[model samples]
Target: MFPLLEVLKSLAQLSLAQLSLAQLFTATVIIVLSPILTDRIAAVRSILFSNYQDYFFPQLTMIIEESDGFSQNQLYAAARTYVGVLFSVSRKPRHFKCRRAIKGEKLVFDFVGEDFYQKKDIAREDSIIANFEGIKLEWKSRAKINEHNGETVSKYFELSFDKRHEKKVLEYYIPHLLARAEEIRKEERVPRLYSRGGSGLGEWLSINFEHPTTFEKLAMDPTLKRMLKDDLDRFVKRKDWYKKVGRAWKRGYLIYGPPGTGKSTLIAAMANFLKFDIYDVDISSINSDLDLRKILLSTSNGSIMVMEDIDCARLEKGGQQNKASSAKFTLSGLLNVIDGLWSNCGDERIIVFTTNHKDKLDPALFRRGRMDVHVHMSYCTIDGFKLLATNYLKIEDDHQLYRQIEVLLANVEVTPAEIAEELLNSSGSSDDVVLARLVEFFEQKLHVKAKAAELKERLKSADIDVDAEGLVKFLKQKKLENAKEKEVEQLLNSGDTDIDAEGFVKFIKQKKIEDAKAAEAK
Candidate 1:
């Protein structure tokens, strides 16, 4: 029994040795052919997954839709974040975003996951998953690829199939996301962008509530920029006719003020702010109201349509009543441009009407729904003066001239144009002298206005009403006619004709001045 047992042990030992040797040989064969196998696998994949370009976009879209809370903001932010990560520690990529590229009639990747989040944090860990039906087959391939330079493995897989996700996020996805986000933001602001009240009949005039000459540099005004940015954002995104929303959002401005204020400037600023073309509709230039309506209808979106000095429009200038004579255009024709049929021609359009004489406009012009807002560019106020000083003179707030300017602003009616002209002519002069000169100029203009007022008062007290001083002399020439007529009437009853020319002339001129004074009183 002992001999048989010993024989069994030796046979078992021999069987174990032979099995170990066979396994070793198999291991040696695999180790030697591993590179070839790997190359074969790569070649096969290059063909099998060659259609990935076709699937890339669809896959990305699906992923985005499936992801929770993947809003436009997050998408836009992600695109930027991915690209920024790629260039941060490197030589700094000149291009900040990733995009699709065309290679031989094929869409190719600019970035993939490995190219972006290749760092040692969540990206290198098991956070990113791989799938087949979920494109799971590509998962192992993708996780196999890592950031160049000793990155940790993507725990979901050893490598990745692609490394160009960064490019995709940056060049294609993020931009659209930002644009959509802006649209959403605009939609939210449509109701409160401006108050809807008070129609304006400024078609006969264009008054810039802000000033015209100063409008050339409107973006420089930080406050104006902020306000305008908000307005424009609402104007553009909410109801642009070009969008699928199928509506043209139009705006109208009524600028009423004393002459030479920045009413025109405000329009220019609005144009600049909105990146719009300017279509100045000169009603006087148009032969008829039909031409004016045609002009308004042709105005494009993102355009500023202006009608300057509307109070003096030839159409409204001739008579108090509306006419369609040579004008061939009626009040109704202009209304079509204001808020009627033609206004819907373009979305994101702004119509601005400026007038120096708001009082002369028709009451129908300023009804409840015509003009969106009426801005009055009144006499230059103290704050406005400082803005002019800083804009035109390059004078800082700390300058002594600013303090003196503040003082003059208290009592002066310096229009922005007047102030602008002074600062421009002598920007290099001492602040004190420049301000003194400015103050003197405004004071002189004021004095001229005062003298004109006094002359008007004298004319009113004399009960004289005339558009020009020539009328006074023209009437004075009739002194003999008045005397002869009066003398003849009196003499007819007494059988005598008497002439009192000298007394008539002296008394008439004095009485004319008194009548002028009465008109002035009214």
Candidate 2:
């Protein structure tokens, strides 16, 4: 005690001017480390008094890489979403970074390296300590340069929690995180349409799908539209029902119609309504059954696989013989891939096939479970015409031409495509002029029908054996002529008669003669 008192007295006698440089530096170090020494003393006291089990409990850790077996690059996205949600609400971090992005003519802000929660020695980097149902968990993010490829970098997240909470984390907490991430992704990103690349390989090419057609905008019978929508709704809700029935959780639709009918339009509408990506499979481009399997396997769940003009794929029973000479895939191979065990691997998938001739398709393709729903897109009905009128001309049901258009629609087989084209052609004209033009077009279809009947009667009287194919060809030719005549009549009726009417008439006569000769040769 006497020696300590003498040392303190000697230190007090020294002033700032009398102190040496080394002594001043040591004093400054002591002053800077005083708080740290105090904290260390408090930590030692806590360790001495606290429960040993609580201080040394085992913590389970999980590391999630940017790429997973199921998704190539989803973990990073999930972590970003998780971190974004935390920073958005808490904003407890000291350091933050910002990124600028343009979204639809608006500038958006994004943040990174923002901490939501932290603890001594336990939480570091972009980490957050969260308590879910009283189970404390810590999430940390890390970035590292790839050892194999120095130029590339990879990222991951580490989740640490008490071992007692492992079950909850595996069963509920992780699933909750994934669901939240998906919700965020859906809100921020536009749906995409994926198609096979042109290289005849199985690679997919993605493009932003911007088709705006919905059920309300499609020109079809209201009853049919409602039925289709109901079918889709029921299918979406039948996931458990499908499992109970021991069937693949998928649906198939067959849309058969003429070229001008709205089969493709309905497909687009269905895609938009369901918010599903479209995988348009070009059957002709596929090289082999192996290639087909690869393509099908590469497609993700919740997508529509479309095969347009399926009848053109030559899917008849014995057509494999003809196909084998040049093609690499067989009819049976396609059928197996479509309905066999491989098809069951995907969930919430839809297969759609469109054709101009349903009768030409094989019976095997129409089996009970293969094509669950068959939609026939026929000629434009009055309801469809009215819908088109409202869409194209904003003419409601109370319009003066509604009655005339209804009456004409009942007798003619004009397609929605033709009607839409007519409406577009007359867009610059007055409402009355447009309606009048549609009336003239309908009248020309009536004229063509009358002429067709008259020709059939003449051919029957002449005892000509007209095959079904020949009759179909003849009718198609007349339909083409009807379209051309409608255009010519529109020009003449629009006060453009001064433009070579005689020469146009002669040209029409010459075309008819050539068509008749061609039909006879066929």
Candidate 3:
């Protein structure tokens, strides 16, 4: 009975100790919760998202159901994205919205610096003002869609501020702020449109065509180098002019030549020369005439678009397109894309079209406005060979190979690509051997192509009609007259040449010569 009582007493003591521990735990938990209760937890809520069903990202999301136009959530997201926090006012908007974003930082950016602003902050307190302005962000929104204040309009940013928040959100939170700002702008804004001009030409070219690397080599041509220098100068000065021109203030070049010519390489050179991205568009991949517009509309600016072998795009490329026959795009559709109504989607672009058969293109499509510069990347001419030797071989006028090259260059219509290859082949060898081997290789190719060209010319002339011969004569005369027009323009524009100055000089010279002739006859 005594042992039983002792056991009960020990049991009671153990139970009391357990109760005391439980009470202490409860008190400690309540104390930890006291501070949290005084200050509310962050009001951040997890929101649902589907990229395809979201407004900002169309490519990342895999969409399903009601893909006809867009899902309801997508439309709402798009509308908010377009009406992106209005910018006219100096203060933040009352409502701040970022719930749907898993990567919310991507959507907003702080625009910093003096250049972006139209008005220079020329106040005496410029430093102070700039400091304040730096804190302010210029949010970039895309204009691919229309969403104005409570209405569908092209996208823009709102500038209202939150008066309630005491903390200036930019300073404490953002480090490497400028770079982050750029990222968000890239993500949220409807990217600028680059020209489909050159990219549109890619659909026409074949990857397996002879001399694929020729395109990269040909851009180094001296005339192209000079042009590129001038082009950069113009781009520097006229960057804003690109925006001002109702058109995207871009340049286009149409490179046309026979097969194995360096037309395509010139495009690559232009891209590399400018350090710009390439937008390769295949008209066949586009489903509808409208779809071409969408693709053109979607590309970012500061890019070059290449269309290779444009002649064959219509005739040879029924096989390349993956979509069904009903979705096959048309020639008219492509032509519209080059100089279409909605083509004015972006600014400062370059379009390049390469063709082995310039004659195959429609005269209307190659008109002046559609193509600014029509470059003939013909078989090597004397001028071209001199440039190749000077550029690729680094041969000076006094060099031994220079004379030999002149002789080979005179008789041959060798492509620059062919010259470049031969130069590279023996680049590590003795320069003399490299030159000799190159001349030999080129002489052989020259004979082969020349014979083929001669055969073709014979065939063509055999089929030429009498009327066509007259047309050729007329075209040649017109071509000569057109060549003279530029000279006349330069002479006239230089503030020289009185209207009758040349005529008066010629009249006096003719009178003197006639008198001299008369005296001789006497």
Candidate 4:
């Protein structure tokens, strides 16, 4: 060591040209190894310092991986969204490249609507700083690749914060991120409606669901609407509670209503409110239970599966519906998918059944856990009409015709769709005119209902079984019989023939035959 130090001192004093070949070679070797030796010493020092620092002022890191062996981790997805929103809101340019929204994808424009394509800013691997409630946090994103395949096997985010803030980070910051991410998704996502495509069996086709229905604008009972919203809130927040109770994280709703009522619209409102996709299941197109399972299992989680006009579906096992039994879907299969073991396949799923004739359905379908919520979409009430008036005509305050319309609505049963049509048809006119047209339509409907009631009562007095179509047919037949009797009475009064009671019956029969022949000839 002393000799080396003397050589280094002599080299500092000597000029480069005067150095011997052996000295030059020695200097070259020292120069070559200096950076490597320095790096090694620094690395050892860093390790020791890190150990001491970690032992005293430690940090806690929460790792959220992209996949949890089964599915994508919810926290990982939320972190990605939250980080993107954070950067955008902070108005800061990040070092890593951000994902750009491509054409045909839903674009979320800021208030200024500039740089529209930059909305998607999720990075594959990057680090960002976040400050939450006076605590500084570092978020690191990383990807792990498979060495053999050179393909990314997993991606993760590390949220590192001061160990003292661990509880707050877990209890508050994580939840806040999830809530904010959900809000961002709701704002940016275009609800998609899925249907079975003709291209392949069990394949789904999606289209952007642009229905504007919302709970605020929906024409339903206010109390019921509030209850539905509250129920949804409870359902979404009770994920862990559901697991504790051993219940599938799913819900079933049976919406029964007459035609022209807003069952489908209510479903659209629910989807918009929840930001869930709609899968309209056409049971007629689904041949058997196996086919139904294939279709249902293909649907993603966090979606609504709707079976409209469920009463028309072949649910009953026996009777006339038993023809081609093997080819038809059954109620048991539906129940299994909705509430049985198969329901555990997905989480946060909603099953909706709509039927015009609820009474026609089997009681088993409405068993406690199967169809949990039953919503009867009744005819439009006074409140419903007011909602429609406000929606269609932008009429917030009550008009002079409101009282009359309310009275008519009380006495009659008209669906919201019918009222909407009336209002829509007269929308170009004044509010008064539009409302008056609606009132006139209501009065006409009332008059028809009154006439029908009178006819129905007359038929009952004559001991006739009156149905809607039968009433019209019976009226025409009664008119024809009365005309024949009048003609026979006129012949008797004219003394055209001396006919006894027995002969009268024979003559009437002959007249009936002739009348039938004449009608056929015409």
385 Cα displacement, candidate 1 (Å): 1.7
* lDDT value, residue 217 of candidate 1: 48
Best by TM-score: 2
Candidate 2, 463-509: lDDT as tens digits: 55466477566545544565577765675465332223244344545
- Candidate 3 wrong stretches, greater than 4 Å: 1-13, 16-236, 239-248, 315-327, 382-397, 446-522
Q: Which of candidates 1 and 2 is the stronger one according to lDDT?
A: 2
Once superposed on the true structure, which residue ranges of model 1 sit more than 4 Å away at CA? 1-232, 240-248, 314-327, 401-404, 449-522
lDDT of 2 at 140: 71
Q: Write the per-residue lDDT of candidate 3 for residues 118-154, one digit (tens) a residue.
A: 2443421111011133443323222222234332222
The better candidate by TM-score, 2 or 3, is 2
lDDT, candidate 1, 71-160, per-residue tens: 112443233323233233334222233443222222222224444454423433212232222232121113334346544233122223
lDDT, model 2, position 74: 50
The segments of candidate 2 whose C-alpha lies over 4 angstroms from its true place after superposition are 1-173, 185-189, 318-321, 324-327, 466-522
Instruction: Estimate, for each residue in 1-522, the C-alpha lDDT of model 4 and write its tens digit.
Output: 124555578789989789989979988777667668778888899999999879897989888986565444677767777876666545443444444343345333211111222345343334567899999888776666566765445677778988999999989998899898888777876678988777335346677787889988888888888888888778878999999999999989999989988999999999998889899887777776777777666676678999888887746743234553333677778777888877787788889999999998888888888898899889998888899888888989878888898899989989999988888777689988888778889998898778667655664565545476764554455445655777657755753322233433344457668989999999
Candidate 3 worst ten-residue window by lDDT: 123-132
**lDDT measured at residue 114 in model 3 versus the true structure, 0 to 100:** 27
